[model samples]
Target: MREAYHDQLDSIFDDLAGICRRVETAVSLATHALMNGDAAVAERVISGDVEIDVAREQVEETAFDLLTLQQPVATDLRTIVAALRMVSELERMGDLSVHVAKVARLRVPDVAVPDEIRPTIERMAAVAEDMVGRVCEVIISRDVEAAIALGRDDEEMDGLRRRSFAELLSDDWTHGVEAAVDVALLGRYYERIADHAVSIANRVIFVVTGHHPAALAEQ
Candidate 1:
């Protein structure tokens, strides 16, 4: 029974890692759809979100069962609790990707990102993708250092979001109000995705050290 419980615990992390990979793919596909105005790809991402949602539910249920049945304590308890939070962050990341795809879908044949802002959006997408990928590694390995480093990536995302806004507000800006709104919202979605990845990383730190990242830094 002990071995079985451990196996179930391992399965929870495994499932979380798999969900991170899927969210990474969703971000990439959504970016492509946004850049190329590919409604089909956008629709693919939107439809596939249900799979992510279902996976999240399964992981959550398993974690809850383990908590209820095994009554994990100390590190094991922290791991289970952190898994719950991490899985939710991953689900939110998936939802953010879906939001990006929805914007692309709404635009249909017309690309949602204009030429001036495309570079910033592209960079945001790349950074968001990289963060999610690193998140998968951190989840599996529980590397506290790597998890903490994700904050730097989050910073870069914030800068890119600011750059996108600068472009929108520039004197030379010619895109209409609708396009501007899309650019602003798209930048926000990507930034929020990165934010969620960082949140999961922080959770990993807490699980391993029994302390939040902020408290560790103060030491």
Candidate 2:
């Protein structure tokens, strides 16, 4: 009975990991679309959302089945629960990427942005991608140290969002109201994507070490 339960636990995590991969693919496609204004790529990102959604549902079902079948205890229970919560976070991250692509499509039709902002956008996207990727790494390896650094990466995303927000709100923002709004929305989406990654990292911390990030800090 124990061996059977262990297999279920491993199987659930295998499906959860696939959810992370789908998010990374969508994010990369969306970032390219944002940077190069590729409608074809944007459409691909938008369409690929279907895969993320399907993976999310599969993860949830697997977790629930494990809970019903195994009634996991201790670390096993914690891991399954964390997977359930983290999968939702990952799914929302994919949606944020789609939002960025939509905003990118809007911007490309109107005018070209200055090169300075492009690099910043690219950096933000890169950090966001790393955050999602690292969380999956931590999950697969059960490495608490790897999860810990995700907070620092998230701070970088926060900084990028703040800088872009200030630029858009500044009096010198000559992009007009429509473009300015699009930029702000895209920045917010990236920021939130980072936030979701942070959430998953915390979940990994809890699952691997049995202590939440908040608990660790209080200690």
Candidate 3:
């Protein structure tokens, strides 16, 4: 019975990994949809959110089952708890991708993305992508060191998020208020995504190493 339960735990882990990959694709599509102004791609990202939602529910079910069936202890207990927490973050990331797609759909014509903030938004997208990628890697390999490294990378994302907001409110962006609003919203989304990614990493560290990583001063 213990052997059967262990197999069940492993299977749930695999399912969680698939959830990560799907979300990564959703985010990438959302980024391209934003950059190209492709209505089809924006629609695709929005539809993809349904899949993320399904995955989130499935994961929650599996985690709850494992807790009751296996009655996991110590590290094993942490594994189920961590998986549950990570799924919440992953689902939110998917929702943010959908939000970006919605914003893209709204800004198809007038109010082109201003010249000043495009690069910053692009950087934020890249950071969001990288954070999701690294978090998945940390989960797949159970590498605490890699998770720590990703946490550091999140700092750069925070810096970019902050600059994007500052530029939006400053006189530097006088021409496009609507575009400024989009940039501000998109920046906040990416920043939140990055935060969730870092949380997943920290949870993994706790699962494997039995402790949380150092808290970065949240600005």
lDDT for predicted candidate 2 compared with the true structure: 0.79
For all predictions, the C-alpha RMSD in Å is 2.1, 2.5, 1.8
Count of clashes in candidate 1:
0
Q: Name the runs in model 2 displaced over 4 angstroms.
A: 108-114, 215-219
Residue-level lDDT tens digits of model 2 in 1-219: 898878877777777677887888888888888788778888888888988898889878878888897777888888888888888888899899889877767667433344556677778889988888887777678677777888877778878888887777788777777766767777778788888877877888888778889733522
Score each candidate by Cα lDDT.
Answer: 0.91, 0.79, 0.83
Cα-based TM-score, every candidate: 0.96, 0.91, 0.93
Clashes of each: 0, 0, 0
Query: After superposition, which runs of candidate 3 have C-alpha atoms over 4 Å from their true positions?
Result: 110-112, 216-219
| TM-score quality measure for candidate 1 | 0.96
Task: Return the clash pairs for model 3, or none.
Answer: none
Error of 1 at 119 (Å): 0.7
**Residue 118 error, candidate 3, Å:** 1.2
Candidate with maximal TM-score: 1
**Clashing residue pairs, backbone N/CA/C < 3 A, model 1:** none
From the highest lDDT down, the ranking of the candidates is: 1, 3, 2
TM-score of 3: 0.93
1 versus 2: better TM-score goes to: 1
